[model samples]
Target chain A: MILLDDGCPDFAGEMGEKTGIDFNRCLQCKTCANGCPFIDGMDQAPNRIIRMIQFGMAEEVLKTSTIWVCVGCNTCSSACPMAIDIPALMDGLRHAALDRGVEIPEPDILNFHQEVLNTVKKYGRTHKLEIMMRYKLKKMDLFSDMGVGLKMLKKRKLDLTPSRVKDMKAIEKIFQEP
Target chain B: MKRSSRNLDPGPSSGKLKFSFFPGCSLKASGHENTLSLLKFCQSMDIDLVELEDWNCCGSSSAHSIDKRSAKYLPMRNLSLAPRGVPLLIACPSCLLRLKSSFLSIKADPALRRDYEDFFEKPFDDELEIIHFFEIFNRVDLKDHMEILAGTLKGIRVAPYYGCMLFMPPDLRYEKSHTGIIEKSLKSLGADIVSYGYANRCCGTYLSVAKPDIARKVVNEIIFKAMEAGAECLVTACSMCHLNLEIRCTLDNPIPVLHFSELLSMALGAEDHKKWFPRHIVDPVPLLKKRGLLA
Candidate 1:
């Protein structure tokens, strides 16, 4: 009861070759989807994403919130009977999505990712207080986790100052390369 | 146990099992309690955990999702800095997975290895063994030590939560069975092991911060499942799992969440327990006090 799409481009093969995920081996059993914690929040389930890739539906796959929302928890990959590295494949898809300049459905998550990198780039290590402050300012939800933040501060869990690595240039170099 | 042929002794000789410790970002920050407890526990075990010189971020989930190159390169840089023979001891499961996966990726592709060397301006020898601290604990014979500490944790029912990262992608995991080492360690410490269905379940991770509603639903399920199984406390190896469960769970009567290292330290009779336990959002001391583990 499935229609053949011989004309479709081979997104699965490209992604598989890049990440060694073997998307073709996916059985459509929905095991990965069933085990996924965020399946309900995802626009397409993990298995559906794999199926879309197999059918070479790159644009649709890239446009969905599935890749953005995927936590890279590796639950799906661990449960996959095909032994497909679904988390790595998801990473590859996110890379592809960014490269293709596809619209990211989850802008806040995207912003958070960039901000984390930026925080690390600036401090060589992540300063939780600074990162949280910047993230809140960007997201404009400064009060969301303020209670927990206060608790962390009182416990001396949050370092007031940033940790600087001796070789800041080396960290900068890693960020600059490619 | 072949020592590194290289003469690079980065830290003072402790005449013990030496490892370059990569605490990752969380350990230095929100997971400070885990760091303090782990350090104290290691000191007691006589393991010399030298901090990796100029260690940078592992990029965690952010770099991996955004750029494949950064994901591999960030951890690769840390691996390159590690001494030739000493295994790298990573406390955070996220860092362990990233470092191990990156090591495997470079090993599988010579071209990628060459590119990394050229890019980092350092030799890309995949000789460094990346070992998680949990694995290190597993190797240590805690049986003798347990006898002394057994009284502290006796009769306390606990659930061991192994979260998703510690047992995933086969090659990177410490054990095939998710809770094997943890369960063994808990039993050795004289605690009642509560069998829970969601022991290896994901705690919704970063989503707990980015999307709390979704994470709360998952966190609630994990907590309720443990409580339903009669577990008085939940101990986890991953800091993110600890954070999610402690912060996100919307339970009226939430159980205490403790890092395995903290529990181990307590059993080993770590004094000034206030230093580590206070950092927890849901205080674990009340439960420990109720169990007669703490004064």
Candidate 2:
């Protein structure tokens, strides 16, 4: 029920840390995992994570790489017989873990997501160069993608200067607001 | 939601053919040509396009990825603002899905529907139907009108690219069968149409910023698929798809990407092809010139 509510924007009148979670209805079907193409890379498949939640194994659920790897593609949500919005729950779980300052299974992946957010927050949209600079400055090895980036730059596909949306502060407010 | 008289204003025009235009962010930004050409076509076709007032972004697939309700509400606010009982013409597939998904969910829940009504200035009557601009173009008899362009694009072959957004989530209801019609439209303008496997491939969308490495890999696949299928040029209905596949890629095997409108506009000789064509990261200018259409 909480998952359904959180997924529906009409009920977002009051924002809170508990974005919402509805875990009671999962039937232990492996369909979400079976249907997921990214399942092989995940430590806990969607079904196993749901089972972990059902078993009150919050620590296991929170710590697993499953939440980070979730593409939020709605494949799991679509395949779930219970029609559980597993993608949204996974997003919620990710936020839950982040709020608690838990280290992600792959720090680089989390850093990448955060880099995007920071870029968008700063310029309202990202420029390839700015993103690369931030990534390299934060951790050096990320510059390895530059071989490809330089090639694209020569072709004028990757602009060195980042573009900004007009009134970026308003755009920033949209992201910063609850 | 209380239905106010202002929200009930039957809009500036009335007929069996009226559509509220929801130009997604791309249309306002880089994809402005698609929107302009679409409006021009609508004008020529006598279809009244009512623009929604004070509309914000539909949040595209981003808001939905982070929060489902934000996705629904983001689109719902726009849907509620539209004139009731008119089919909404969506240019962006992402926006169409966001609106349609919210609409379907609202009908399934009474409390939520009622709560939505209370929040909006006008009560949403569940009367708004989402339709794509492409659907309108193909459904209407534009054959005679398109025939005028038969001599314009003499020898260019276009592969119609739908990308992933236009076909996914099962609810957008785009007729995959329209491939023939799209081909016919281009051919009517005197361009040869090619078949390609990348017609429905993913373009790494927001991931272009979110995960550049993954995005590059995904975009490479789409490009390779298009080239492998023997398409000389690629045409798309979505601006973001065009931007991603044609503009954002790091690939060397770049093909010209044309918005369906730009292609049609070129055929009509109504487009300033130089302004639009060269701006693309992968210039389609050479392709047009090859066909002697870019003199």
Candidate 3:
């Protein structure tokens, strides 16, 4: 299912245009994969994703868990000999994936991200407790990390109330954009 | 990110240095000990860090990962709020990346700067200085404040875990980096830094909650390596790393994770360990007491 399809030949070039990075410079030497701390969690080695992009396998690359699993720590980009902005490439791919409404390989991660944005939209800042609660509520799996949540609460790490900004109009102006 | 040529303007004892501090959500909400200790450290060094008033989140990982527009605007809003002619000091590495990259982007592109100005309804100040907490060290030597030149943390052994601080994105390669500042600073304070391979390893951030299994494995590995290398404790620069390392590590007899601010304040004889120590999940008091660093 993950094999290459030559239908989207413009994928790599378009990504280059979007991110201002040249994927052609990638040596495929796997410097990024080797340096990535999250490599174990990814389905594809970071290099393979680049190869997939170069081959115009847009759907496969978009659907892969590697893109979502990447936290954009820039470990790969910094270590890259070709100086390819691999994380930027990933961001381009992610935005493209969302635009196309493709099947997300990692929905929970996306859900978590959405929840964080939701908090920021409401308060003009991230409310960790609210984000965590809503994220767990959406998954209907709140019990899994209850111990860690309680520990954080006990430590006063998670605030009881959200830190709000007075300029709601300014926050609204930012979030109201398409 | 170029360091000012005048790194040594006035020593810590001579005058007060003022910086508009941007304590990201982590330090503001969850990392009480970190904030308390950090403020204490600044007060002792004659450095006055004024909080950025009504400052919002710097888009964080959420904005950039999914929403491009929000990412651009979130950090831009914070930039608009920056007071004229003063350095904006950010403590979180992730927050720094978001805000600094946004600043650099606007500075390089006149169109983006115009858009930012038009959006925020304020004129863009290109001369605004955005710096990190570590930048304070670059401006002064902590030894000036140390009454005993022989280092305050003489008996404590610390493992400085950077966790995604040194390796920045390509766009920010030219920015001033904090390479070895942790080890160098702590060493100057008399703390022996343990050598470990996983000091630069990623702490698996949000994954600690979304995919705990994966985060668990990585956190355990990092802790195990530091402990294996004879580190009595681990010190981190980011509050998120401190949270993830403390929460996700399932290993037996885990070493305490101290914020860099805590160690710095302690070494400088702040005498407020009682307020900070109880907040830690893995208490450093027993270890510090055993080493005679804390009584």
Candidate 4:
């Protein structure tokens, strides 16, 4: 029940421009799908997303959980017979999805990424504790993972203080730049 | 497998191997023990690591996935921070990929190089060698210390969980690789390598934070597989993978996951388990003690 936008017919070409990967070269051999460890969590296999881009199904492809669920592990791209950078493709799609203001199938993942960048923007490095607390605050369901959080604290896996870059002006400039 | 491994480059000039080290966010903030043991191992091997001054994030998976510009700038800034001539050694696998791929891109394009130089207010050194910690193995021969280090790791069974480090984008496919470097280096150190199916399985990184269920599933599978393969402990090459493996596994009595550097430090006769082992959720001390690796 999805219709291709005859307007942006070269969606694959557009993605290639964004990620520097030629999606048209994908053989659709399912090698990427077979090797992807997070395939079960992905609503669609990676190659299907590539095919969607090829067919100009931008809305469908951008809205899929596959892009957001991908941790950029590079399992598929490494095994890709066509040698396509599948993870790079996912990154491109996720950016595109965010840019275009489409519905994100995995809002939690998006929230996590935002929390991570938020800390980096502030401290010039990631603070696991802050990222977690901020994410839980935003999600407003922190108690669910309290056990794991407590465990990490007990093991000192999550640090109370962020190891920051000495020159805040430098990182401030990078984050502020257009 | 179509993934090709490359021959390693020559070791550094005889005595002291000094280089700039970027410990990325994972090690810098959370994995202090990984940093400590890594420094210990490097010192024992006479590898002097000068930490990169004011190095920022490497555009971790989160950066590239959300904002393209932040991703480019993060790694670009780290590149600008690298000292000239001496290679910049990144400790995290993901950071290595992010920085290395960006370096290759800047190297491949002239205009982008100028833009990067202009933005960062630093010259892009074409000769600046960006390397991973594994690359140091090519320069240091563990066998040379066998007289003192022998029998230190003899009875320990380790599963080397590379966890997606080897399976990077094809753009970097032809670059120098560290495939089987862990197994090769550890075997020479006398630890038994236990082969497992899930050694290369992705540890479901940020998912452990966002989608714990999926991360939990994959983590348990990896740990269970390693245990099934008779591994007494796991040696992970990545800090995030080490964290995820320890935290996400829901199995009862999971094996201790040690950083590759920690194991190397132990085998090199660096007796500092007290500093490193307590940080681990699953303490490797009991296993190391049982194997006579500790007094």
- Top DockQ: which candidate number? 4
Order the candidate numbers by lDDT, best to worst: 3, 4, 1, 2
By TM-score: ranked, best first: 3, 4, 1, 2
Docking model 1 quality class: medium
Q: For residue A91, give model 1's deviation from the true position in Å.
A: 1.3
Candidate 4, residues A1-178, lDDT tens digits: the string is: 2333443457776887878876557777999899888888999998888777877898999999998998878888778778787887887888889889999999899999999999999989999999999999999987997988999999887888888989898888878858
> Model 4, which residues run further than 4 Å from truth?
A1-8, B1-14
Q: Whose lDDT is greatest here?
A: 3
The superposed Cα distance between candidate 1 and the true structure at residue B279, in angstroms, equals 1.1
- CA lDDT of each candidate? 0.81, 0.64, 0.86, 0.85
**Cα shift from native, residue A51, model 3 (Å):** 1.1
Per-prediction DockQ comes to 0.70, 0.14, 0.73, 0.77
Pick the winner on TM-score between candidates 3 and 4.
3
Q: Model 3, residue B57: displacement in angstroms?
A: 0.4
Quality of model 4 by C-alpha lDDT: 0.85
Model 3 ranges with Cα > 4 A deviation: A1-8, B1-15, B147-149
Supply every candidate's count of residue pairs whose N, Cα or C atoms clash at under 3 angstroms: 0, 6, 0, 0
| Model 1 segments more than 4 A misplaced | A1-7, B1-15, B170-178
Q: Interface root mean square deviation for model 1, in Å? A: 1.5
Across all models, the iRMS values in order are: 1.5, 5.0, 1.1, 1.1
List TM-scores of chain B, every candidate: 0.91, 0.86, 0.93, 0.93
**What TM-score does candidate 1 reach?**
0.92
What TM-score would every model get versus the actual structure? 0.92, 0.71, 0.94, 0.94
DockQ, computed on Cα atoms, for candidate 2: 0.14
